[model samples]
Target: MEIIAEFGSSLLIVGCVLGFFMAWGIGSNDVANAMGTSVGAKALTLTGAILVACVFEFAGAYLAGGEVTETIRKGIIDPSLLASTPHYLVYGMLASLLAAGIWLLVASIFGWPVSTTHSIVGAIVGFSAVCIGSESVNWGKVGSIASSWVVSPVLAG
Candidate 1:
């Protein structure tokens, strides 16, 4: 608490910058993936796909991203365990953002499809398990999310 109070402003600034980079990475990687099929099928031109993606992405983020944001923020790890060491949570989140962003950038460059959500979730799980003990993580929630990775595709198909 004391640490957070002392460095709250600086942390907020850093968080904002990292968040921007993460969003940029999502645009470069996930957006391309979302738009690829349409472009490949010639259903939309590259420019048209970009325009459509920009509009829908903004809409989705603004209208439907809240639940996901909350889940990621609180569902993956037990926040009560970090009450005594708030700085660890902040640092972990920052590190996760940096790692996920860099990974998304690299994957985009190589034309590898990746889920931004999975990257961040894996980072959080790794950090919590390593830094705060495996007990701090919500393994059940992680398992459910992991299962969705397989289940969703199968169901879609």
Candidate 2:
């Protein structure tokens, strides 16, 4: 069926895309941000930060990232579910990434402190709302995730 094929293709394409994003996002957001503070403090030169960032990032991701991949759901959604999923989901996701990227670039250019992790999650939710109607979204998931930001401040404090 043409519908079935379309659904399959969309699911696979999006999954692969999201997988690539996960890896890059981890290296870019997690590793780079971690060392950004040191660079800001002038303890490490930009080149030094980048080189060490490359090494430690690769080591951490290649070594421990497997644990993270293990926790991801490969194909929890059935093809039937896929068929019901709107094509706009893909568009929304792309837009979300675009927003986050633009935000991060602008913030970095202006030397404003912002959180990439927060931006990504916000992008996803923003796009999710565009794809599925806001009424269809599970607020519980959003709420729980928001709790992470709240908890982080308490944890840091």
Candidate 3:
């Protein structure tokens, strides 16, 4: 009600909607993948898995989601000169959320095992590159993220 009314700003309103879509897409696909194995192995019934995921997802969102959101807002793109033109950051975020949500939906429909993290990161990078120029992006952070993607599996195996 009031929260909905609070979205009087166009970008904030759209961002809220797109954020919902992204969360729904992520929940439907990524959460299923995370819980599938346990359900398959009979360690958790489908209901049990869903319930567990609901608890943990809510917890994670409440606990760490703010940090992630803050990072996405200010970490990836340098907003040093955005004081006069502050709308681009909102535009970029809206675009990133929509892109990531759409990518997740497409990948899930095609039965592809896509990582939501990667999708969001890629969307942010692409948006930054196109909208703000590649130089505005923090390539060093991107490089670290990419390297972890490569190193994680090697270490896990």
RMSD of each: 1.1, 5.0, 3.9
Ordering by lDDT: 1, 3, 2
Instruction: Please give the range of 10 consecutive residues that has the lowest summed lDDT in model 1.
Output: 1-10
TM-score of each: 0.95, 0.60, 0.86
Which sections of candidate 1 miss by over 4 Å? none
Better of 1 and 2 by lDDT: 1
RMSD of 1: 1.1
Q: State, as a TM-score between 0 and 1, how close model 3 is to the true structure.
A: 0.86
TM value for model 2: 0.60
Candidate 3 CA-lDDT value: 0.83
Residues 37-57 of candidate 2: C-alpha lDDT, one tens digit per residue: 889999999899888988887
lDDT, each prediction: 0.92, 0.61, 0.83
Q: Which stretches of model 3 miss by more than 4 angstroms?
A: 1-8, 155-157
The model with the greater TM-score, 1 or 3, is 1
Scored against the true structure, residue 52 in model 3 reaches a CA lDDT of 98
Give the per-residue lDDT of model 1 (tens digit) for 81-151: 98888888889999999999989989989999999989999989988999899999999999999999999
Error of 3 at 28 (Å): 1.5
What order do you get sorting by TM-score, best first? 1, 3, 2
Comparing 2 and 3 by lDDT, which wins? 3
Candidate 3 structure quality by residue, lDDT tens digits, 124-156: 888878876999888887787789899999999
